[model samples]
Target: MILICKPGSPVDSAKKEIRLVEIEPSSEFDAEICSRFCFVSLDHDPLPRYTALSYAWETALTTEQIKVNGAALAVTPNLGRALRYLRKSDTTVAYWIDAVSINQDDGEEKLQQIRLMANIYRCAQTVCIWLGEPSESSPLGMSLIGGRAIEGEPHELLCGQALTTEYAVECAQALKEILSRPWWSRLWAAQEFALGSASVFMCGRQWFDSTQLIKDGTLNMIVSILSIRGVPAESLMLLKYVGSISLTQTTAIKRLWDLMPSQKPSGRAEIFCEILDQCTTKLCSDDRDRVFGLLGLSPESLALSIDATYDNSMTEVFESLTINLLRHLDSLLVLFTAGVGHPGDVEYRSGVRVRLEDPYLPSWVRDLRRPRLEWMFPPWYGKYRTPFNAFASKEWTYRYANNQLMLKGLRIGNIPAVGLGTVCQSHFYRPGEQADGRRVLQSWMALCDVAGRERGRDPYPHGGFKADAFCRTLYGDFKTTIIMSGRGDFNSVRLQASDVDAIVQSADWAEKLAQYSDEEGEQEAFSIPPFIIGRRLFVTDTGYFGNGGAWIEPNDQIFIIMGCHYSVILRPTNSLQSCTTYRLVEICYVHGIMDGELFDGVPFTGKSEDESTEAYLERTEQLGDHVIEPVCLC
Candidate 1:
């Protein structure tokens, strides 16, 4: 049996009126045989205790016509399944399922309900998150979560060694299937799960404690376990685990956000950018919800200013979001996540060539309507992992109106050399692909050689002109060895050193590099594999080495905006008037001068003792005074 309520009273009324549906459970197994009745409210009544159903509302669900209060009502098969599972056999169970409890046809009522969603979820006794039907992996995954302990205490499951028995493989497979569910990608589900006081995730008849799944150190445990099993660090499966764990990690992240002390309002963009980072991969039926669904979790002032108005188009809503974010936040950090234009256009290597889905969008604005496989640097990876001040200089002034951005910044120099335009000639980053790895490695070496000659010095800062130095220059630090529990025999073993010697001496380096597997022999000072995916290496005309987008081309100028921590690449556009305009390219990381401290100390100098030094000195002297100009990015 099930009870459904439809609100009939004004949202602000002191007295509330709701229409209830009293459903009678049937002995028949068929959904068509169930009997239900709609009970219209004749008087205001106190709301009854009910459970909330937070689900994906899958767009592809087959509509099943069922009798709701003796009338034919069409409901998605997924929703129908949930209703049938949650209904009680004898007593009527009250539920606040979004599809049925709210009047979908009424715009006013919908807006009112949406505004009250946070309170509703918080007040509910429990939130049952349905993840469709269970697979072979569900029960196994639940068991592993509850009972698996191969080496250390149960709590340290993934951190320590795992017996390489058949059981270990089963656990891996179970984890993979459990995380592949569609429920993880829904944008609305993020806040719904976060707001619920007591939440249990349901997949068919099996339910797992959400708290246990996201227990502290879960991600580190998973990474440790996978590494022990010799899973390649760059493997797609490992990346999937990272993505899945990120979904669970949001619980703690959101809690911290909720606990932050409220002070004078700075701007919602800071909070909004963090939320966007967490929910970037989440799916939404309407593109606008990509930004709107996060409003409640933002500051009260932000939420109040941006009403729950479904009347606006997606582009309009996005434009409004951009304008408000810029007005309140003094930084352009939000644009950091822009991908290669449209999803399909991602194959292009140059940032300037990255096609925009909307021609009207300002060059600085990125569209978040679709999800892409290429992962951007995590926000925490940036300085303090918080939004750094984008206003780089006191002289920096920006004006935004008419959907245009006008700002002042210094143009440092033009790029004389650029690294491989694309990673393995593909949009997606899969270093595991054998052929792709060869191409990427070759392309990387070629660029290093070119930039090395252009700068009149070795590309590597250490180990002058050696292959190891080139390896460091190319992969950052893949040469260092690590210690971990052995998978085959020894209780403790070391991962091998991946330095230039190991990579070049062996024929399997291509495949080996992909796995990044190692055994401890000798450890050299090598930093962790640089998180340099989607990065392009470049040398300026003055021979200052830096990194920009792979899409960067020869002659593209690097600009240091007043407040930006990283330099932005810009391309000069054809201007009919005397005023010059530049298109916003991707932000860049220069090797030793990201902090701008290196700018004032000394002019760029070449390390070579050859005649190239004279040429480098002459080129350095050719550098002129910094030029400041007003520019428009649209």
Candidate 2:
């Protein structure tokens, strides 16, 4: 008998009927064997505790068939292998495998199964993870891991003492063999692993302690083993795929995340952010799974009714995530880490680099569908990247309606001048004459000279005067770094006046460059060519000069947009109804004005004596209402 759950119609619920397949155990695999099945109503009968199968859906191996109630049921080669291993000669096992248990043709049933996925796994006595047929090294690997499972204290082998050369070599092979499985990278696998109460990893006919392998010190042991010398190059190559599942999935395993094992517990927002950041590289068939997969693990996921619905479009799902994130979190800090590079082919610094030309997405929103660009570094030689958290709470407000993002912000000034772009070929040079600090100092001086000449307000008429003012404009603080000289408030630079050195004699500059070299590495010629080429020196209307992106044009508007952590550049378009519209040009990296520390109360009296930002705003108001409005990005 083969019990088939009828296709879910409009009037029927997912829980109305149940399909059951009674799998007969056999000694070995038989291609043409038939099995019996029955249908039971969940409302009338008490369901039996069964094992749930968790495995990756391999597309190439999907044509294989297995017998069910005298009929051929198509399945993946991996599933067929799993079924063969689970079968016995005399006994029949009651198992809940999603592929056979759920009606795949019915969209309603599929959605319902996804909703009940957490409970289904939790109800199972054991979760069997099929990692396909084992390799030649599988037995050795299992034995090595199994050996560590001593009386009550299994991981003592790993934590006891430093591994010997012999042990390291052996563990290296074992680790390479174990991590090479495809199960670790799947998004659904992550959720399945977390929801299961007890797990059993099945490979061929052999079984191992799945709990110990994932939660225990197996990864650490493998890392240690690989670190030892004399490991083969091929073995080392295999270790590259050995990545851990997200912390969220691990949290779901315990059914509680009040306190992470190694991490200090924070609020739900913090946890969600961490999970999203860490698991950006995890693979999923559907783009929506990128957001939906983590909902089961996140404690605050209930706030947004983001259920597993197949009806929602990709854009709609993305919109839902963005809107909900904004509602839950006060700041739009995530936008700062969004996908960005040069306009055409935005390359990543690490991982698999693929160019994305998504004109549909707004510049403010991150393309969650793309591969994680979290590894991409900013264009600075030795700059330490820190999260933007400058403003106090309630400083910014945002709303998303009619597919438009609205925000309250302030206008800073227009970009008047920029620096030379990286026109030369990308270089792969050492920390020699190419990375000379004197050259950078010269470029700064040149920018200051050009801007001063254009403005007709030359602050530095002499040699050292130019260098000193340029330094002050960049790194000088208000109260301390800038001192009131006889002429005006002059920012000071501690430059070394060496008698032998000619071009910008300063050991301090070299020392600064050296600090960056240590953090980022010496060979960075290929990394920041865009930053190098487009290193435009931007001079604001108020005479504030600093280095901005090459994309920053002469007329580009630099704004301190509220809710955004970094300063954004926008190009003014056609005027509409007394308001000037703007298009997103590019996000810039202006050295001094990034945190708005210099934008606040800093005096700019170069144009007029004692005229502050307040005075400029007052004058503008007297002229006419110049409303700084946000353009609705489609």
Candidate 3:
């Protein structure tokens, strides 16, 4: 029998002993291997449903809103289906499978395919990330990975370096040769992240070596693909392997954040909140100009946005005021739903307990019988709340903790994410419509605590509320939760270690920061100065938003206040009257600039205020080019 392989080979003499068969795309071939002692048997058929289902999703997904697109991605977890959907929309979509399709009949074919895999994907327009499972049930969460792997590579800028991109060495000789050069290696692939079972790394052309910049032809090839491809080979493919980074990488990530352009905003209004969600941390206000200056806004510019009559130090006056107004709207609606015929019952609150079973929890969370415990539950709590005494007694007025034990009940999960409140006393009772003069002042502060020189304070509305929770001074922000264990008033509250730790540590930058001191006698360039909280500065601004409205413009200027942003209907609260416009009260500090200039940027507006809220949001989203992220390659 004669055996044949595909074109391109080097065998001048040619070996007569081995025979090969070249197989076509659709025909059946022999599976038995006679030359060897074993003859493998095969029995299987094509999975048409898998392929057919995939085709439909890929075909119709582009114009349709992804959130509304079939729940197949959420329920089925089949990447092939998503690919099929994309295929329908983009006909140029070509399926890239090296193993079975290319006839892996021998080692030659295998090597050729391996060599071409990188190029094939690199050349494609869109790349689909197959992170989730094909079945409804898969380890998407566990598989979710972030950050590039850290390495001890000799870094030029920071002492240590973190990997954020990737390089391919085995496939192309030119690629391998380039990576072999110490200077070339450090120039491009020095800090990179490697992802996927195949260890592929997607990269871009533009690379800045801390201070110097250079371009590589090889790297340019990868960058060209990112810029030119109408879409990537894989539109939304998630790799199995996660990249990591070193201490240097961590610092670089923070600095690189400002340099990295924001993604073009999609239809989702909430997308804008993520930038500040983590908050503009990592540095003090002084350094804001030097590092974050690239962005449109500077600290002084942002501070200038102060509505003359509004508090100047309001951390985020616009967002603060907007969210407060929305909260008032929610409160009014709540009172109306309660059928309380009066204007005295309308008011919203900060940190409300999320209901799990009021048909509010998503099918996945409820079906899995798991709350997001990581956000709220401490590790010591374990699978059950046996160690938590808060739920031990039944008559505790705030006995709602015990009610969380039931599966269907609205139970806070062990995982606690940001934005979710840690406060608990307001769980059972509904607040009255009228302000009970029971509002808490809030502010975010940054501090530096040396052995004997550390202090604390709060920063809020015009920085004068002198609030008890957040203490602001020249130092950083710090917090303390004053809880009433037994029946008592605010003065009667006792602070617990766990409770107090939560507050102090909530805004604590201790772990992420180091102490620094600067003076004229101090040597050349020095680190940032440390802040010590002097006294609790509080803002009496009644319009600070809690967590309602947040918007980020591609221009980099952003707004974040809390309350219903996307939903037009306001939530119900204790309300006494029906007014066309609502008002909110809060304490905060607003400071930031647009593009390093000392001017407060105005929110984009249209015909009506409601229309302006969305118009400004739309304008912000329209700023950036929807560039695709590079895949990780090894």
Which candidate would rank higher by TM-score, 1 or 2?
1
Sort the candidates on TM-score, descending order: 1, 2, 3
Q: What is the C-alpha RMSD of each candidate to the true structure, in Å?
A: 10.3, 10.1, 25.6
How far in Å is the alpha carbon of 199 misplaced in model 1? 1.1
TM per candidate comes to 0.68, 0.67, 0.20
Task: Note the clash tally of each candidate.
Answer: 18, 10, 131
The list of candidate 3 runs beyond 4 A from truth reads: 1-195, 202-538, 541-634
By lDDT rank, best first, the candidates go 1, 2, 3
lDDT digits (tens) for residues 251-283 of candidate 2: 333444333233332244444555565556567
Give the per-residue lDDT of model 3 (tens digit) for 78-114: 3222333333332222233322223334545443333
lDDT of 1 by residue, 496-611 (tens): 34444455555543444444322243222111133445555565665455545556667777776655656677777766744466667667654433445434543433224564
Better of 1 and 2 by lDDT: 1
RMSD of 2: 10.1
* Model 3 steric clash total: 131
| Candidate 1: Cα lDDT at 451 | 26
